[model samples]
Target chain A: TQLLEQSPQFLSIQEGENLTVYCNSSSVFSSLQWYRQEPGEGPVLLVTVVTGGEVKKLKRLTFQFGDARKDSSLHITAAQPGDTGLYLCAGVSLGNQGGKLIFGQGTELSVKP
Target chain B: IAGITQAPTSQILAAGRRMTLRCTQDMRHNAMYWYRQDLGLGLRLIHYSNTAGTTGKGEVPDGYSVSRANTDDFPLTLASAVPSQTSVYFCASKASAGYSYNEQFFGPGTRLTVL
Candidate 1:
């Protein structure tokens, strides 16, 4: 079974602080996606990285996919209170059909102003 | 478009009772999925249907069942609820027109508590 392990399960930071969340796995994936979920809401797609060493940016967020396709990372620059939420990384395995995803245990971020 | 909607925003049930969570999508997505979210577990897929009339079991399918009678709805049923089954349930759908990066649109989620 493939599993994605995420680091720093919980983070509490002051406004304008930079933080990075990591997701690692031994199995390779075809693509990786980042999602942000607020309380009582389902996760919303942030970005999708399909190539090895790919980097995608969305405003204050930067997402990187590992060259081996076995890991990924999300970095938040100058995080504010609005950035506080649960971040999740999910991957689509090679040759998998129907867009099935293997999700990592989320990283809960709390940004205080 | 209404996207996806789930019924019974929150529910509380006895341990031995049966429960069904309803999900409907107006986007006409070809693939629909059911996932359960718990603390420290993120979201684990319980079941999925690639299209109407076909369904597949997911990682944590031991205690849940799902059915897709049409293109718009996928409902999940728990035959006998257990305490460990208490979790928030989310329904998601994805279109299969081209090479998909697995961009699934999700519902607001249903909070279920088994007492």
Candidate 2:
């Protein structure tokens, strides 16, 4: 089975602080996606990176796919209270597995204003 | 339009009781999915249906069942609820337009507590 492990499971930081969350795995994936979930709500898609070494930016957030497609990262610049939530990384394996997405445990960010 | 909606926003049930979570989408998506989220365990897929009348088991499908009778609804049933099955359940849908990647629209989620 393929598994994606995320680092710094919990993070608490003051507003304006920058942070990075990493997702690593031994298996390679064809695509990786980042999602943000607020309390009591379902996750919302942030971005999708399909190529190795690909980088995508959305407002204050930046996402990067590793050179080997086995890992990915999300960097938040000047995080604010609005950025506090659960960040999840999900990957689609080489075959896509009928559109299945394997998810990481997730990194919970608490940004105090 | 309401992209997706789930019934019984939250539910409390006793062990061994049967429960069904209803999901409906307005986008007429071709694929629908059911996922359960637990503390420290992100979201695990319980079941999925690529199209109407076709369903398949997902990573954690042992205690659950799903049916996709039409293009817009996919309901999940728990024959005998267990304490371990208590978790936040989410319903998602994708257009599956043959693209390598697509965004999945998710519902607000249903909070289920089994005791």
Candidate 1 Cα outliers beyond 4 Å, as residue runs:
B97-100
Every candidate's CA RMSD: 1.2, 1.1
Tens digits of lDDT, candidate 1, A11-34: 999999999999999999999999
- Model 1 alpha-carbon miss at residue A86, Å: 0.2
- Please, what are the lDDT tens digits per residue for candidate 2 over residues A1-113? 89999998999999999999999999999999999999988899999999999999999999999999999999999999999999999998887656688899999999999
At residue A64, candidate 1 shows an lDDT of: 97
lDDT of 1 by residue, B1-115 (tens): 5899999999999999999999999998989999999999889999999999999999999989998999999999999999999999999999862345958999999999999
lDDT of 2 by residue, B1-115 (tens): 6799998899999999999999999998898999999999889999999889999988999999998889999999999999999999999998982444788889999999999
Q: After superposition, how far is residue A109 of candidate 2 from its true place, in Å?
A: 0.3
- What is the two-chain DockQ of model 1? 0.68
Clash pairs detected, candidate 1: none
